[model samples]
Target: MLKIQEIRELIKLIDKSSINEFKYENDGAKIVLKKNGSGESQLAESHAQPAAVQSVPALQPQASVPVVQQQDAMPAAEQKEKVQDETLHKIVSPMVGTFYSASAPDQPAYVKAGDKVSKDSIVCIIEAMKLFNEIESEVNGEIVEVLAENGQLVEYGQPLFLVKSE
Candidate 1:
């Protein structure tokens, strides 16, 4: 059986490569990994018959998801600006995990549509293996949309927020 660290390293490596799927088996041990919608990843392993399947979060760059800007907090009139263009920037998830709009459920969201932000602003948080990773914006602009819902399962490189470049 492979150690947890080895499995994690393999996952990181596979995420960077173009190979969509990978499978390996030897001496009664088996492992399988595959990419799903956009960049989400699924992994399965077994040591014997009737293998047990488990869900694993994807690992991808944070700026890869492409999406348009649309925010709920903006007025309808302001929301219509430059929406026809497909060049708006996006803040994407760095890893597969549960996405949270705020630090706590009851607290206000860290960012919403129509909010101005800098390249280093914190947009949201992603929780994986009991660790919370604060996702930051890589572009300076006005947040025009929030693509991922609060507490939603976000895949690697999935679009979390859309920003209209300044």
Candidate 2:
């Protein structure tokens, strides 16, 4: 179990560092934190007006969900719809490796939900054996969902994204 003080300390570190994303794992548990561009900017701006630090960390218990506004959080709900739909297309991993969404620290993510993809489109970067491999989409369609989080380990034939049939 995670101690309250430890969780609070981690939150402080996240806010202080310019690197908004971090991950750490041990034998028993794993912790990950990321900053949403809109969310962070909004919080920062709100505080700049009041001259007070927005110190409350957004953490909802029992749910491993990223904090976002209700409207911006539609991806999770839409993701469920995509899963339930009878889509016959999926972007599968070609090799067993760790999946990365961005090419480098300064690069934008390869793809996100609602992006149109083609058979030649590079949808993600899969790191295998210390090499970063660009994983391409095998189908031509709109990307409806991304199944894996950035930096998550993936296996061969794993369904990384669900694409609606063209």
Candidate 3:
């Protein structure tokens, strides 16, 4: 998929060029250019045909299977995952900027393993362009892990903090 910035660049290039038609592929997107007889540039539109899909076989239950056994298996899986939850932590981002956990100037780190944090604690700062957006923790517990590294771009729902919620 082409980024929003790349699409803007394509539009600019089409306007400046006197070529009637242009087609190029960049960043996984097919760009097409078409022009009128008078050399008027037109917006590029990519056309793609859907591929054929193969049939998939659906799983069926055997007549000999017991409903009680199936029910027991479902609960066992859930129990395993829930038990491991304590050893795991969730990382969440704070803002709409790049995420960086480490500090500059040859510093060690703002956080690490076995770190305790409160719900309102500042886990990390997200830098958007030149501004710094502080990310805060939503849970109070011990820091189990870090989800994103320093200077990593993060989306709104991107994980940035990991804590072992008590």
Please, what is the TM-score per model? 0.65, 0.49, 0.45
lDDT of 3 by residue, 1-166 (tens): 4543454466457667766566777444465555554443444333353242211111111223323435355688787865775466676653356776654537666677688888877777777647776667777898876767776667545656657887
Q: Candidate 3, which segments miss by more than 4 Å at Cα?
A: 1-91, 103-105
Error of 3 at 94 (Å): 3.6
Clashes of each: 3, 0, 11
Ranking by lDDT: 1, 2, 3
Candidates 2 and 3 compared: the better one by TM-score is 2
Error in Å for residue 19 of model 2 = 50
Per-residue CA lDDT of candidate 1, range 1-166, in tens?
6655576678778878997888878778787877765665567666665544334445432234544455787787666764643578978887768999999988999999999999898999999768999998998999989999998998766888888898
After superposition, the stretches of candidate 1 with alpha carbons farther than 4 Å from their true spots are 1-21, 26-29, 33-52, 57-85
| Top-lDDT structure, candidate number | 1
lDDT of 3 at 154: 70
Please provide, for model 2 over 121-157, each residue's C-alpha lDDT reduced to its tens digit, 9 standing for 90 to 100. Answer: 8999998767899988888888888999988988656
